[model samples]
Target: MTCDEAQILLHALLDNELDAGHAREVEAHIASCPACAAELAAQREMKRVLADTKLSYSAPAGLRARIEASMPQARPQPSRRSVLRGFAMGSAVSALAASGVVAVVLRQDDQQRILSEVVSAHLRSLQAGHLIDVVSTDQHTVKPWFNGKLDVAPPVIDLTAQGFTLVGGRLDYVDARAIGAVVYKRRQHIINLFVSQTASTEHRPPKTQTMQGFNCRRWGERGLNFWAVSDIGGDELTEFVDKFEAAMKVNVEG
Candidate 1:
């Protein structure tokens, strides 16, 4: 992870809000980075000091009695039927709102979990001997490498004419399941395009996300989910995906 990305997540790590996967990723980065490690220590010290400091102020013992005494003597009460109707309406509204909130939270948690896994897999692939199980530039040669290796092999597109060269392919684990990673190279930057089969055949437009200084463009099409991750610029990454998708369409039609 980059220092900048680690900085943004340090507080979340300290607050214990990050999920186990992300927490471990951030902690691993900090272990190797002295600057981030020092910053985390400082954050821990500050939190400890704040916990020890007492900032609450108590009101006078009779403050509640005085406030009650100053209230109007007479007040009107709603009818029992009206009160019951209002309570029922409020209960329904609260239930709807709570359900909506829970749905949103669950979606966010799932997204974060997947993203953390993708980033970790990408990092692991960078290590020597972990990159490609099959190394070849020809799409024909690379595409057949995954025969029987996975339920569905990812499309290996030869984008060398478009500036992104086909490096090879690899098998990686994401979200606890094996997936195909079609590796590509943009100049010196490596892009790992992770593909996994999805139940949905619906199409999802590419959405860009950044994690630990790497740009990831993810989308779904033709019952497969794609995550293209690299250190390249966002625009370039988008262009890569666009060209890739276009090429895939051409191959499918031709």
Candidate 2:
């Protein structure tokens, strides 16, 4: 499913209006596209915001009783003016709720899709026996390799002092955009730190997620998005994120 097609039917997918097979394919495409995932999140947030908004209008005491008493079962119901006013109010509320549902359904993919891509990339690299392009332990050597390949060179760090050794690096893709993946090792486990240049300038701490038994943590800063994926423990993976972010700061200053 292309991005445009998936986007067009996002509302249907969100509302369970699509068949299972088609929904799966659309979800698969979204899983590999970061832009779609973020868009999906925004749509969900809009739905939640609408849901949280409370609209209350209280009628005077005995209002219901008065209406019931004034009604004539055999004759015509309440005055046309009153009936029309009630119908109008009911239709307005229904319309607002329906619009909220539509807004929330727009672009219905979420962050889980991005996490799936991260895990898939890591597993594909290991299973296909094609991992790194530049095999080197020196940060200086590995960092320079991306100079001509990408618009910005990802800062490579030698975290040997922290027990994560720099192994190599490679070019990868996410959401149709080329990105850099720096390889690392902790004991026998391999860590693939995926970095992509984005318009996002979020400096918030990373969030950890387990995708297919692998623990991954991702965060963003100064238009750069990073994702570290491996089978390593969540605690250890978090430490890795902290060290990497600190190294990023040092590299920026230097």
Candidate 3:
């Protein structure tokens, strides 16, 4: 594969989406070309970093119910004849409806872009020399430290036995509200988990998402919304979430 072609397929190569033949060609090119090799190395490192960091966030409990209530009711399927007539007429109403949907979708995309940016900034901060504005392992100390800094108290759980120690936390402004950034450590890796009390709006469930070398998982429960981001491996990160959730469940029950 030429350098240009390899560059075009870089993301797909990282995602393991390329066909076997294409994958082989890209790999061969990467091995022979120093620049491509460096790029591949960087991508691999980003994946590792995302998998190694330990961050977690919880979505509010009411968010799901509210989302269900707010969802627009499905319109009755149009009759074949009605559909044909509308197509023939190039209906103004249909055009307007389509435009409105596009507008809403664009707006939502913009919001998501902003959220990603905020998350990226927070991630960069952790890598910098100063990670925490308030450093404490005690949940009591960490929770209350945000009393005046944020409007809501973020849950601070210590998972030292699970190989993730509570490093500390800081307050961040995101989605037009003050959110909490809880720091944790897994060996030398740092995980930054953001938490906030969302209103009655259900976001996408907690699933692993990768953005610019970071892995993020978002979920909601008990009126709390959680978003965990790290540069940790997918398997290990999922394991961390499983253990963290189990511990949180036990704590809640108690």
The prediction achieving the highest lDDT against the true structure is: 1
Off by over 4 Å in 1: 1-108
CA deviation > 4 Å runs, candidate 2: 1-110
Q: Where does model 3 exceed 4 Å of error? A: 1-111, 201-204
Query: How well does each candidate superpose onto the true structure, as a TM-score?
Result: 0.57, 0.56, 0.53
Per-residue lDDT value at 146 in model 1: 75
List model 2 lDDT by residue over 1-254, tens digit each. Answer: 78889886666777788899988887888899998877777777887887798766655424533443455422222243543453566664333323333222343365654555566577657765778999999999999997756655687889989889999998765544456899999999999999877776768579997754678899888888889998889999999999888887897898
Q: How many angstroms is residue 232 displaced in model 2 relative to the true structure, after the best TM-score fit?
A: 0.4
Per-residue lDDT, model 3, residue 121, is 47
lDDT of candidate 2 at residue 25, scale 0 to 100: 84
Tens-digit per-residue lDDT, 79-121, candidate 3: 4454455446565533332333323334447545544544444
Better by TM-score, candidate 2 or 1 = 1
Candidate 1 lDDT score at position 195? 95
Candidate 2 yields a Cα-based lDDT of 0.73
